[model samples]
Target: MFCSTELAARLEGVDTELIIAGSAAAAARRPGGDGFTIPIAGGVAAFAEEGSPLDKVAGLGFAGVPEPAELDAIEARYAERKTPVQVELAHLADPALAELFTGRGYRLVNFENVLGRTLHDDPATVRPAGIEIRPSDDSEFDLWIDIAAEGFANPDTQGVASHEEFPRDILANAMRDITAAAGVQRFLALRDGETAGCASMRISRGVAQLTGATTRPAHRRHGIQSALLATRLGLAKAAGCDIAVITTQPGSKSQQNAQRSGFDLLYTRAILVKD
Candidate 1:
């Protein structure tokens, strides 16, 4: 129900689907460009890759996530050929689905945490503690990637790599390209000329997605994130955007910042991992 149009655009360009398996719109793989509605039962018994053109059944359906047997069937469909597989659906309705794949020999790897808050176009932008906010240029890509890896606490130093393996360079390139195309605006918070923290905002169809809110060790509790968030929301207001969404952990500084910046909770979407 909450799909980003920018995501739809990127998926169209890359010929990929996000695999949203759910009860309301189950067994329907909404095509990238135009969409279609799927009328099926069993609450998304499976989510498979698009094989042909989707039907124009309201164009708002979901991908039928495959079971272990279904995945095996699909894998066997290609045999020796390898394919990238990703699933980003609800963990409640089909909680055991990922495990089924792992039991069938599919390696479970990598994860991402998501948070969101509705956009307020009239919030005040306050840059407390002398924190500076500036628009970043193309040269900041590698730095952004580096900071991201650091923020994520990744030790590999593997720059911009996807969750999957194979052609590391190619995946990194794809990651950069996708992130670049998200129309994300980056702002770096500086403390006496050093990078204190950074935040990225992606605006699409009157919805603003806030991500990559990170602060350096020495810059914690200095109101750096507060300034950055206020500034970004102010920019969104000036640009006529209506909603801002951000995701953060419970009791985290990022959560506090969002609340302090006048962001109210809309909903929470969780990512369930296999132990």
Candidate 2:
């Protein structure tokens, strides 16, 4: 059910491997993403892009890597790129089947090391910084986009802001409409009256998504990101969210911050390229 770019983005610059949904594979490489695509197996396939010809898990065989002919079949049907991709075998997948993956030079990057926690029980603590937190309004869209571009990453790049544009930018901007109508808050942190960082969250249906936290290069070591995060946690608790779900890089400064702020690591999803 996962998209290839989604997996690739999470893995980031590691370049180990990427798994993908066939739909995303069909979309030509996204300039700032994994650059490869894979296909989904079931219901969520509806969400996958149309016209992908990749096979489902069953047809591909949960037993092991497919036979040479079968693998050739997947390659024939999967036409978005020339790169090879791997099918992730879940923990429950038969061991014999998993060996096929191992035999084919595909290594399982165990993601269990990543963790998550519920925010409902977290106690907020005040931390000191010369940061001022305020709401992000439509008028500040440029600042918002700039901050996102500055904080988010682009595949195959160095330095945070040195990244390129991302596909999620379009999707995220669309969701802002829903949050805007509900008075869900998006906050910006400023150092000495200039924007230093930004974070946004929405408490809805008892779920608080700690989304979009960023710190400008000049603002690092100043506690701007942490303050914004703590503020978000307080907001979630005040609004009565039962849990917060954050899916960031398995290990990054942002991911560590989330874990430290009472967030727990959930199992990870991956994207892998076989060849």
Candidate 3:
């Protein structure tokens, strides 16, 4: 399928909006609730904490290129906090945006691919034997967080690109904050009466964002991930979302799973960092 710029605009807009909203949610839940979001450079500059994944800029350059002063102000926000400024610029965004970052000393750090597929009618839900996928209840919040964190800790290295790794504690905290974001839904995959996998979905503006999914090291290759994906798509369609999107490291197992499930390569985002 042809990937159009308009489609990129819509998908990236939703993703970035959620990033901002998720950061705001994390800020409010903290002790002092100290966090901020700034609308700059035709996108958003958000900070949840010193090393938060959310402390970055996104959906940039869709509007006219910002003046150098505007870019300087964005850097100042992070400079005051003594943290690097990171930008996730979509390949389809205004080319000048990339040039501006390079000219300002932002070096390429990483890349992530945004994949998507249209949701129409009902999804063909996959029911793998010995596995059950169901909504995570409030009482199981911590359990879900632990399972997700553990999965990330033992990541699958069967991909072309390398992925960043974080401490297990930090991963747990990030999962908690993101799952608490507005409209976010959690799912737990059970096998043999034990939790085996966890996933999340967030719906906004007719888009269903497959926020994350991971299976425990001991439970890998039990069709847990596939089941989780199919279940979320079905629910997202029921909720009236026309599009479902997922971001993954290029050629990772996650991306391969998404591709097998009908998602197309919508666009790639270049992560540029200024330290």
Candidate 4:
């Protein structure tokens, strides 16, 4: 029998592991800082390019309650790397993990809301007219990366923009690494033959995670993002995924669009950082 809790746990585990794997892959293509993984209390911490914008320990989760010894070990690992310890904690994670981080001087830095919806046979039926979504090709890779970078650079979006100029080389390298190793499916959204946005889907453990959904600033409010979401969901369904998930900042335009597209709020995850 498939229990809801069991399913949630499974999804959470795979989601974190996938992030770790993707980060390590991207770090390998960089010049310095070899990405590595450390066994933590109940999960794993993946360290990527130290000091780079992409650098962080991902998938920091602990099973049940964590002891002080476990917290010490985790901190020691990050200290050895000379990088601040950062953890993105899922809402469904053990409550003790948050308490331990708070007790250890870790501050909450980001809050991300996870949304999900069951995949239907014709998930793209809701796609807006005049917008076309298709699998991205090698020739379109640069454009896709550029669009994504621009979208993320918007002040309205979360996260600090490292540089005003697009980090083209880094973005290209990371995209190549992730595409080769993460089983990611990239899609480009076009409005009447012009590139409007980009989205990606990574399927694992019978679930499809929608990520990197972004629209060019000039293309906002035209339903491009919602159309991309529908297209990705359709693709995931066709690929045999039972459910599709996405994450966004709470109460943001992205979250509003997601809710309008029939996705329900699953939980909100927090990013904890120790400097």
Candidate 5:
């Protein structure tokens, strides 16, 4: 599919809404959690909590460029809570957005790529022998979080350097809140009857978002991720999603895997931060 401003708007809009929903879930699940969203320029700034992974600005510059005063107010909002402003600006967004951020002392921190593929029929998949993928049961929520946090804590070293890293406890917390969000479905990959990997998908407005997936360090290279991806894609297709999307650190292993599965690079987001 052609990458255009209109396409970017659609993709980013879904992501922004997901963030809002997840933040709201976090607030309801955690003690003293803050679920707040502010409109800045054409984007939405989200704050789930101090140091929460869900905190960031998305879908910026889709409406129109913001004045310096509006940017100042956005910055002030984050500053009030001792949090830095982290904006994920799509490359296809208005060029003036980046210029405004630079002029306002925002520093370019990292880049993440968004890849997508249209979904129609069930995706063809190769399931490694002895591996099984299934929806996680409600009773296994803690187990799911533990596996996800463990995988994240021991991330693969082959990828591009990560833009941001968090402690295992923080990762666990984030996973819990994300799972609490409406429309999110969690899946577990088992190898020889042992849990080896975990993944999640969220469908909104006919867009299936592969929110995240991780394999236990010991389970890496066992095709667990591929199985998880295939299962999610099939589920998304069956759920009537028109398209599916995923975000990954630029040049990272996740990006490599998605490409191997026939997803196309739709856009890259520059993570600009102001502290």
Candidate 6:
């Protein structure tokens, strides 16, 4: 007798916890900074570093409208750290929270479409000619990071500016640390035996979240991403994951590729920032 909305909320909460945990682990490895999570009124606030990547308050949800005092305290905490207060609000999140933030000057900065699909039978996909996808090894770690950084730097992608400023060494270190954490896997896509793209999966609570899927500009329109997506789906299923989820910018080629590969839109999440 569980409602679909309730189920979605529960799943989202689990996913958010995994994200916060992984971020905290990665932040712990930072040379001069640390990552931590703070419990707020609705959900947890995850901080990676003062000005580092993905330093934001995310997975925000509330059973009911939160009091203004609670919101104020959250903002004050981030302000004290000299970083912008950011929140990610899923479609199912309390609408009142959005109103409260907007009234307090939080700008709607970005949007991400959450897509998911059940992993049953292995999805059929043809590996593009001269392309191969395989689990990454230590030797290919640096190459994977380089390809990911370049793919995310494309101006056509969301938050390209943030990705552009990411230092390669910092990113490489973070990736190495996070991927080493439990239930995380990285895959490399090679075209003619040369690295062309990368994808990552983090499994938790019977769900696999596919993230960091990127293909170099020169490798686009060649089905590299689609092949990787299919490969990961099969891997997730083989790893005992019941469902797979992915997030991407709305109307982007990434979304189109995911939908074509069997993922359906679940909901859209909005990113609000107070800077």
Better structure of 1 and 4 per TM-score: 4
Q: Return the TM-score for each candidate structure.
A: 0.57, 0.55, 0.94, 0.86, 0.94, 0.88
Ranking by TM-score: 5, 3, 6, 4, 1, 2
- Model 1 per-residue lDDT tens digits across residues 1-275: 24363433322212122112121132222234222222221221122223211111111112344444544544443332233333333232234554654565544343323334444437775867667877666688667555544554532232222243223333234334334444557777787777767777766566566745767766667787787788887787777776666755544556666777766543322322221
Worst 10 residues of 1 by lDDT: 52-61
lDDT for 105 (candidate 2):
67
Instruction: Give a tens-digit lDDT track for model 3, residues 1-275.
Output: 55787878887778778778878877777768557788865688888876677788988767778889988887988898888888899999999888888999999988999999988767787998899999997799889878987988788988755435666665655666776776678999999888999999989889999999999999998899999999999999989999999999888999999999999998899989899
RMSD over all Cα atoms, model 3: 1.7
Clashing pairs in 3: none
What does candidate 6's lDDT look like per residue over 54-154, in tens digits? Answer: 56666666556667787777677777778888777887777777788889898987787788888777778668899999998778787888888888766
Q: Write the per-residue lDDT of candidate 5 for residues 112-138, one digit (tens) a residue.
A: 899999887668787999999999977
lDDT of 1 at 64: 42
User: What's model 2's lDDT at 203?
Assistant: 56
lDDT of 4 by residue, 150-264 (tens): 8877635534322223365666666676677778888999988889889888998889988668888888888898888877887788889888888777777888888787788
Q: Which consecutive 10 residues in model 5 have the weakest lDDT in total?
A: 33-42
| lDDT minimum window of 10 residues, candidate 4 | 157-166
Name the runs in model 3 displaced over 4 angstroms: 31-34, 161-163
Clash pairs, model 4 backbone: none
lDDT of 2 by residue, 160-254 (tens): 22211344454354335334443446688889888877777655456665645777776776878678877777777777875565545546677
- Write out the backbone clash pairs for model 5: none
Q: What TM-score would you give candidate 4 relative to the actual structure?
A: 0.86
Worst 10 residues of 6 by lDDT: 155-164
Q: What TM-score does prediction 2 earn?
A: 0.55
